[model samples]
Target: MKTAICYYSRHHGNTRKVLEAMAGEGDIDLIDVTTRQVVRLEAYDCIGFASGIYGFEFHKGVVSFARQYLPEGKPVFFVYTYGGARGNGAKTMEALAREKGCLVLGEFSCKGYDTFGPFKLVGGLSKGHPDAQDLEDARRFYRDLVKRFSGGAQA
Candidate 1:
């Protein structure tokens, strides 16, 4: 299955690290939302939205891109990195994707090195996170999703 990940990784590039690990598994497109404002997503069998959480939400650029360019009824997944643990980090992105008439696949999130806001005073939180172990976990997650979706596409 052809897969694409539209992402915005800023600050420490923590989110990008995970994505790079997944992409290293091969056949995944990583579209940087900051540079590419518009994208053609129709050809992809599965789409992923990724970012470093800002204000406990996926970056606005990602949200806005989904609102504007996400094709309806496509399968969607989310990948996010956050400093602090939350009950459901992908809730906002999940709802938005659902509203766009997409099939919600799954989500993968991990701790990122965060120095945002008050955390900055103390240096940072989750330092060296989204580490080797985290990246391996992310790769496994992506592989599973690909395995699952590839079958459906073939069928």
Candidate 2:
């Protein structure tokens, strides 16, 4: 499958680590939203939108990308990293994807080191996160997602 992962990873780059690990597992194209603007989504069989959660939501850039460029009738998945365990950003993204006529395949997320805003005051929540274990879990999640999406087709 021609798959692409378009992501925005700032701050501690925890989200990027997950995507990188996933990239090694498949022939997935990686696009950093900070550097490249996604103009067309139809070029890929599947697309994965990833980002770090901010203010209990997806980064503004990620939301904007989904709203503006997520093509219709394509399969899409979400990957995110958050500080707090509780949040509905991924669900909200899923809803948006459905509204856009995209198939919701699956999602992957984990608790990354929190160094944003208020979390910085207390030395962050789950400090030193997106650690080795988190990366491994992300790798597993990515592998499962790929398998499910491929229907056991060759990677």
Candidate 3:
């Protein structure tokens, strides 16, 4: 399948690390949303929305791109990295994907290094995150997601 992941990873490039592993497994396109505002998602069989969680939400660059460019009837999934060990971090993106009439292919989230705001003074939370194990898990998540959605173009 032709897959594409549009992401915004700042701070430690934690999210990017996981995505890099996922892309290594196959012909996956990794597009940094922070640098590119628009994407041609229609050409992909699967579209992945990814980002580093800030304030318990996905980065605004990713959110904005999804709202404006996500194609209808396509299969969409999410992958996010968060500082905290909780929350369903992909809801906003999921909701928008659904609103655009796309098939929800599910999500995968992992802990990422964070030092935004006060944490910077105290070093950071999830300091060595997107660690070896995290990257492996992310690779598995992507593999499984593609398998689960393998039979259908839309849900």
Candidate 4:
């Protein structure tokens, strides 16, 4: 199946590191939201929205892309990197995807080095994260997500 990952990875690009590892092995298209506006999402059979958590939320660019261009009824997945163990940002994005009438196949999240606001004071939470293990977990998550979506597996 055709797959696309549109993401916004600012700061240290830790989120992008995870995506890059996954994309290197899968037949996926990667789009950096900073460089391109997603005008069309219907071109792919599956799309993955990814970003680094910002203020306990998905990045503004990724959220806006979903609001503006996520195609109705298409299968979509989510990937996010956050310093927190809980994935509140991913959940928020999932809700938005549901509101847009897209099927949420699955989601993947991992701890990334935090560089947002006050986290910097603590030398950033989960420093040096989206580390080797985190990247491996992300790849495994993406692999499973692809199988579920392409193989007609259930949630």
Instruction: State TM-scores per candidate.
Output: 0.93, 0.89, 0.92, 0.89
How many collisions per candidate? Answer: 0, 0, 0, 0
lDDT of each residue in 1-155, candidate 1, tens digit only: 68899999989999999999999875889999878655899988889999888887888898888887789889999999988764457788899888888888889999999998899999999999989999999999998988877777432
- lDDT of every predicted structure (CA atoms): 0.88, 0.82, 0.84, 0.82
Q: List the residue pairs that clash in candidate 2.
A: none
lDDT of 3 by residue, 11-43 (tens): 788888989999987779999876755578899
Model 2, 61-137: lDDT tens per residue?
88778887888878888999999864776877888888988888888888888867777898888787778888888
Which candidate has the highest TM-score of all? 1
Error of 3 at 48 (Å): 0.2
Q: Which prediction has more favorable lDDT, 3 or 4? A: 3
Best of the candidates, lDDT: 1
